[model samples]
Target chain A: MKLRTAFFLNTNKMKFITLIVIITFNTILHSQSQTGLVQYGHKQSMGMGAPIGIDYNANLIFDNENSLYTFAKDSLEGGHIRESVYIEKDKDNFFVNSKITNKLGFQYYVDKENKKLLSRDIGFNYVKEEIPTINWEISDEKKDIGSFECLKASTEFRGRTYTAWFTTSIPLPYGPWKLQGLPGLILEAYDTNKEIYFYFKSIKYPMDSKIKIQKPNSESENKEWITFSEYKKTLINKHKKAIENGRMLIEGFDSADTAEDKYTMGNSYIEIFDNE
Target chain B: MKKILFILLCSFVSFGFTNERIEPISENESAEITLPVKVETYNFPYENGTITLTIFDNGICEQGTVTGTLSTHCDDDGIADYVWSGTICREHIDALIMQFNASC
Candidate 1:
């Protein structure tokens, strides 16, 4: 009878152990199911890192000696802006290609390969230009960005402020736009609104083929290198006549048959294109 | 044998109670969650229409259908008045607060 009692107690202990093991396993499974699964390359491939719906408002104030001044507010409604970014990396150098679209259906492709930057205006035809090189000062601030550690950096080029955040965690110095020169990958960068904003969307590590840095096309060869300020001046001069024609068309001058009819048009055009 | 059976029954009861009586963790105990969302009210000019949006927290957003006269505003007139209805998730209250602060 004592032996039988001993056997029964041992069986009970075994059953208790089995139940505890099962409970622990169930709890672990439940916790694992609740955890989020992260996709590493999804944002990179879709180019979704660009901040959507960024509203830009600029107030232009003109002051005269007579204290007569006028202020005009220009606001840009937010929309989905698409940018195409391409990156390739080798042992010593990196290549980056970025394309930004404008309202006039023109696309600007800024290519940086082998520490050289080329800016190309891509329309129905390509107008490529070489940009003057500017030196960058690497910063030391560490930023945690979506499972990557990025370092903050800055550069000043021709009255524009260029801030860059790069991550050495990815081992590729390539980033969006012409921003580069880090140990890892660039996450977010901008030139203070006057230029451009290149936000880190994703990083791709290709499995095959070495990255080859391609030279700019022959048409872009031997072009005069200009500062960003000079480029802006040239762009304004090129689009000045077109902007005037657009203003006239928007004013309904083409539809008016008489001068008085045109004169009766309200000052809405003044609010629209007062930048000129 | 009777003692063994009684012990097994007691263990089963204890297990059942532990499973059924487990309490959920309160929101205060959890980490802070911030979601980015936007809501806008628009009144169409010339036409009598209104657009109202309520974005949810889980990113499963819903847009209230637009209704009213289809007129495009050429002048700087006030938007038309229309009614829109939609339910937003409870967790999106923080997102609404952030958006309000940004706009203000």
Candidate 2:
């Protein structure tokens, strides 16, 4: 036989090249064990606050204890854009406060070295825009959430269509407010009209050891970055005259006589930019 | 021997189809919850009084003790007083009173 049929055709071409290198290393170890792990959950309820108030322009306040305030008028009026209320107390600790306005010729910049709180109009020095740079796209399907195991990713920056879900199993990649760079940690995100969702409510990992990380001063830093539709078209063209004078100050406003004269006030503003 | 017993039964059926096993809790399952308890009344424009409290558990506010005049305009003229007790856990007090009645 011609050398045993050329040694059985070279062992069937080395067993078809070892079954294509073990099926391409088992499809890259099954997509790296399905993207490792790091999925969390959270979606509490109780919100009625944030209803019109952005000190400087945009107004419409109705009060009876059903609060609704907003403020950040025109290109988010000189830095330190105000409108605070974070209150997280179980998966860590939190506290934020700032909703007092009406002092005129403003000039407040309390950047506890970037904790943020800037205001200016007393002598004007405005001109600081930049905030737009987010990109992601990791899909191939996989879901579980609530014991971890997620994937579905997306990104269309500035004009909306976020939709994130990351994981890698509890590897801490933070989320809830300023979304983070994924690889593992975005628990959940929304946009396509869920209005704005962000879920992933708990994670402690802090046994008797201080771990602080807060820094953002110098007008709460931001030399560049934009898109969220260029900060919502720079907040509707710099608060289109404070949203037309806060819809003419709530035209004939009378939220139940300011909720029975419990003294209610309102304001609104939204101007953010850094890039589109 | 029959081709080495068919290559050890095809390597134990390809290692039992690549080790498939996932449990995710299930010991004859059992879990239920329902919570809700409310009695609102808050108006403390910095302390001149009126806070009939009662929002227990999760963001707890129990019969919080405090009464009258603490002025800063009594919390900007909204009146200032307090009184709330506690006992929530009916599925987190009906999900915080359906997220404070927004019927979440």
Candidate 3:
């Protein structure tokens, strides 16, 4: 007891903050206030134009007022595919593997009651922004997916036109990977170009005690939250660097004509264009 | 990448003729130069595999697990030797070089 007290005294403020987080975490786990959790299979095209796209698992965990959109556990391990362009001294034909390297490391935390959206991107930068509105064209076309009747809805989001199937039976607007504002729980989604696909895999009506929805960096003092403008600026700078590196790699290659192709290069991203 | 790895392995597995040079000297000089060298391979490691490096007195440095091997001079500078690390999509690409206890 004396040793524990000494340790706490040595790092008083940090320990106190950690203690609060621990208590809150335990309470969230044990309490009956949580709602549901769902898993989705996310498919993305390999950049080098390989037919077999990489697959990932994403999760949507929700309570009464908040939801967390993030990657599922162990999903990213086998999902990574890197494109390596090897240029030989004499051989001009360079082999470009159908390696898709675009993956989002951003986690979205939505505050429904407060109408605020918080996200942590690139593992460190915490950004707060208003939720972008998606103008969905809901149609009466209906289909049954896993015993749930779903309606077809299409929306042009960020540069991709996506068709989503949401079931009104659940009466929840939660969905995977920021595809939200639905009339009900989204079960499946796919882009028009077939480059991106998301499908509902499983769900727990009441989230398991072991399952957790992470609180944003605002809960911790070590992280200082930034605005979306700041986050966008940082991303633009990173994007420029990546383009520069790609150009350098392509400069000496004989097959320079195909240098800008996404399959031979990994410059393509999920958001083809994002004005906001 | 595959061809490079195959060629490296082939060169290393050559019967007795590698692309390395070593000239024999007199018996008296050889006797004075003979010394016991011990090396233990430690993996600093990555999620995909281990980042292991083992160096010899004859300027032969072999990297295990991942793909690397270069002829370089060395001395055992312990675990905290010059760390060369980068990221393979936000995750660390941890690489370490183990310096040997002998000079080339």
Global lDDT of each candidate: 0.34, 0.33, 0.51
User: Candidate 2: deviation at residue A6, Å?
Assistant: 0.8
Candidate achieving the largest TM-score: 3
- Once fitted onto the true fold, the runs of candidate 3 whose alpha carbons sit more than 4 angstroms away are A1-34, A46-51, A72-105, A207-212, A218-221, A256-258, A261-267, A274-276, B1-104
DockQ of candidate 3 compared with the true complex: 0.02
lDDT of 3 by residue, A1-276 (tens): 999998878799788899999999988665644578877777655232222354666778887667887752333445544332222112221221122222444478888877778876542577887877778899999998877899999999877788999998777777777778888888898877556778788877765564556656655637788897786666555445444433332222222122342321122345543542
DockQ of each: 0.01, 0.01, 0.02
Q: Which lDDT tens digits does candidate 1 get at residues A1-276?
A: 999999999999999999999999997665433311111111111111232212222111111100000011111213323322223222321112222223322122334332334443321223444533546677777887777787888887544467777766555444443444456556676655422444533333331222233333424434454554454454444334323322322222111111121110011110111122
Q: Decide which is better by lDDT, 1 or 3.
A: 3
What TM-score applies to chain A of candidate 3? 0.69
A201-236 per-residue lDDT for model 2 (tens digits): 443332233222222223433334333344345444
Summarize candidate 2's per-residue lDDT along B1-104 as a digit string, tens digits: 53244334433333332332222455677533223322222222213422121222124323222111000110111111111112222223222222211200
lDDT, candidate 2, equals 0.33
After superposition, the stretches of candidate 2 with alpha carbons farther than 4 Å from their true spots are A16-18, A32-178, A188-197, A201-234, A249-251, A254-276, B1-104
